[model samples]
Target: MTIRTAFKSMSVAELTRKLASAETASLLLALVEMTGDTAPLDRWGKWIQGPTPINAEFPTAEAEEIRAQVADLLIERGAQTERLSEDSERFRALTAAATDRVIPDAEKPLVLKEMGLLDEAFVDWSAVRPDRADQFPVVIIGAGMSGIATAIHLERMGIPFVVLDKNDEVGGTWLVNTYPGCGVDIASHYFSFSFAPKSDWSRYYAKQPEILAYLKDIVRTFGIGEKIEFRTTVQSVSYEEATQEWVLEIRTGDGPARTMRAKVVVSGVGALSTPSVPELPGRGEFRGKVCHSAEWDPTIDVTGKKVVLVGNGASANQIGPAIAPDVERLTVLQRSPQWVNGVTGYLDSVPEDEKWVLSNIPAYERWFRVRTMLSMNDVMRPAATVDKNWDGPEGTINEANEKLRERLIGYMRSELGERQDLLDQMVPDFPPMMKRMLRDNGWCRMFRRPTVELVTGAASRFTENGIVDEHGREHEADIIIFATGFTAARMLSSYEVVGRDGVSIRDVWGEEDPRAYLGLTVTGFPNLFILYGPNTNIGVGGSIFFQAEAQSTCIARLIRDMIERGASSAEVRQDVFEDYNRRLDQEMETLIWSLPVGTTWYRNSKGRVTANMPWTSADYWNMTRSTSLDDFVVRYHDDERGTAHADDIYRELDSDVARTH
Candidate 1:
């Protein structure tokens, strides 16, 4: 039996004894977080209340054991998990400045001693350029993490910026996905921004409520909410060549339209916002209630209903196992198979004692988080490169691909004992990491349930009652779920912004592909910035927070430089943007995402892989550290008409909107 199964069956004393083993501690914690009675997750309510006070301390031996276990896991992964040398004077200088961002003073002594923080080296962007300080008014679209993060850095620089969001709420993706098992695959320790860490996360992998609350808290704590205009969708932006300003038209919630102008426009409307429902026949004829996973219906009754889930991407990977038990009959429609990596459990709440230690011990949790960032976040980016010799059936590369295959295959054998047919149907022919790997430690086990059915080779064409799969089989489902992913390559789909001589952005790129220099600004579009833009998605496995933070820092520096230079606009030189994209395309030629053999959403019809980036998060971070005028065309102007990026974007709502009767 799996350790998880044994954990579920253990008694209170027996469980505590099992948890005493450092190897099983995280597993036991996962079990408790999911099913424990000592502390309930829902009871914590909303909002980040700041660092959890460590009322009690663990025995030194026990605490050290936990740290050792984490280290072992990193070693097992063959990651760049080694720390900076403590004896190095250079390391001390870096750490001293990074203290505010990465180190916790209370936990520093023990943490630094064990983790070797002082001697460890870091590239402090703050140090590289003290002359890099520049400021400008900035316009940011989309009020998600990417937008808020940009605002955070701008605020620290005392630079003014505003964020415009079409949605009524601030927590972009988190605000939409309310599924049962919806949470992060990456550990929360590494998932957050280093400058504003949340030491009080209830679970290692934080759930939706906790993450949403964190975003809300950041907004409140940083006073970022004051910079956002809610329920305002940006519809077409235009640039005046004579004035060098962006005139953006915004539609209010009640339908009143107005124009706002800014020095630069940045779009943060993330890739996954617009979901792609497959172009299948009779899709409109599903009589009963149906919705995409992103647009989950909280009030809709899935209980005792015949449910059908299509596509096994990240969304399907999560929802399939979660709703299997609650519904009467559940069918997962698979067109193509995907390799699922071993479920790293982190959905549970953090233990009160551990939470306390994390908050009180200065360097302890912060150092641990840095390790988690390197191990869980940055480590796996390289394996995404396709090996030419990997001419196998398809899938993952190197040792990573092999180990993941073994873990998942073992899980399958354990889950489906008597039915080899079911196991084969569930398994994929490809190697791991070729595409994204999903985590559902509970998935295979849930397959054992009699109520669930895994339908393989379901090349679906929507039918009246439900779906008609390839083998002429008709599955009648009360509800249909279109987890068909999203339109990822088509960046900035909405606003038709005319820049510099009435050149519309759509006319410049067409439907073929969207290209940007460092995924921030376009050549023709001067002073326009994008967060989580085209070719910026972590083509490999990494924390989105890291990418967002990096992009935020990049843009913040750009604004700072403009203010200091007193420049009106800095547009990417055409040749510079083209050369950068050429090298980028060359780098992508060897990546798995460029595979022409597979039918992946990563590739567009034109054979351009515009959605995913080929480099590591660290590499991207180093590239975006600062803005150089050599990379752009710096426009000089001393006119009263010139404005900052955010000035004309957001506006305050009426007293009635804030009023409660």
Candidate 2:
């Protein structure tokens, strides 16, 4: 047998051991080594001797030449550098490394199992009621990632579904977020469909155009675009039990109104699409170009223009340093400092050879996908937790957060050089997990820019020309980008949802917080399944796509149960939903998102935690794999067959397969 045959025969542990010792990745790298094409990475000059540490220093005299070369490379690729650095080379390396490192060691089976990537997905895959055929029609709102993904599974089941979007085209967040510096923070390779892996990626962290292109590619590949009704916004959605369908009233941007009905309604509008502008005394009076980063106007030229970026969330963190290079002077106005942890693969781009391996090597792509998921979910899971018992500051959590703080501060001190004043202005006061933790190179590098100004104080009010700071300093600018972010605290609040007995979803969640049993179904909403619904957000921070897939699969099973039972809907038992939420809240209270100093969107006005799901991604996955009647009370349309669907939920299956789901 050839070496290929021998390598394939060894167990994963042995392969890993061989891989670790080789320095080269594996058989693939060895093949490249034989060709002598893989040069000593340093010769490329992509890396340099320590300015501080790895790559920063090039001989001082050569700095001008290198900087000019870096600029030329950046102009060719529309990518962010740390959102901090505009240089594409390092980010390219990270993307390359991420593609390599994304492959997991041992849990290919488990990762494949969770994602239904295995041949034996017969059990888990059967949860979607494809066999019920035309029993129910599914209507989806928002043609974004979550909605599109849900439709893909539904299509595989042969379930009739249509996707509606407010935009002129599909690609929800990816479609709308067309800002200059906008690109995905997640590695482009893994920030996509697990079912469909791409071997052709030009950038490690793809820009908006590339990200949008990926969506369009998926739409074409899956044949979902034809099912989508673009530029049609959902006006109102009312659930009707008599017919067991949703009354969807839609309004097109052209002023035409239409109505449709479907058994299931899924919202992929996402919690982040709507731009949340801060209420100020004088608004909209800016003479020059003013727009939210989400709704960026490409026509607005920032060259030589004084730009003022409001809000230092993810968008501003990226947009600030991104446009700063082109602008005359850029000023960033921050509300509260957000914790920005360093992410490894954000800048790394995958090489063509590695892409070839990921594509042709069978399990290579799957293992890499699993590895990225595990890196995001399993490895970083603990970082989101708050240890209240350990003695620390009111805002800061225990040793872990302190370590994160120190790590961030260390980076700040290094990046800031000798400027302690800038360091004091840059560091965050709130705990790590309070707000959505961002990973950006831009935040650190923003201060390093000579023309960039970092103002720590609050924006007291908006002036006719610029933003006025709390200390009475006016930030003069011709261009303003509101990176203030979205109203993520309010989930499902954008839609007009009327559940059983005319219970408004907004009214129900009024003044308190949003809660859902298993984060899939609500108690009052029977036959209604929500994907990426209330409290479903990963609190500790993981991929939402994982949660989306799990939730969609879990709900698909419930839908299957309802159809099998001859019932129109699935409803969580009031008590059961309440009890589950109680546990979730209890978990939240223990975490950092619950503390006094922890003022964030994760919590509501009443000091109740709202946005995040406190459980581990694995825990959430296992809990949602199948449904039990004990967790919910079902309803049948017929008066005589009341709650029959509840009984049918757990009909013991003859097949060992159904038992697992």
State the C-alpha lDDT per candidate: 0.65, 0.64
Local accuracy of candidate 2 as per-residue lDDT tens digits, 95-158: 2333223333233334555333444232234444435558678888888878877777777667
State the TM-score for model 1: 0.77
Find the 10 residues in a row with the least total lDDT in model 2.
78-87
Best by TM-score: 2
lDDT per residue for candidate 1 within 429-506, as digits (tens), equals 765555677776466666678888888765457677888888879888898876778877666786677788777777
Q: Each model's TM-score, in the order given?
A: 0.77, 0.80
How far residue 457's Cα lies from its native spot in candidate 1, in Å, is 3.7
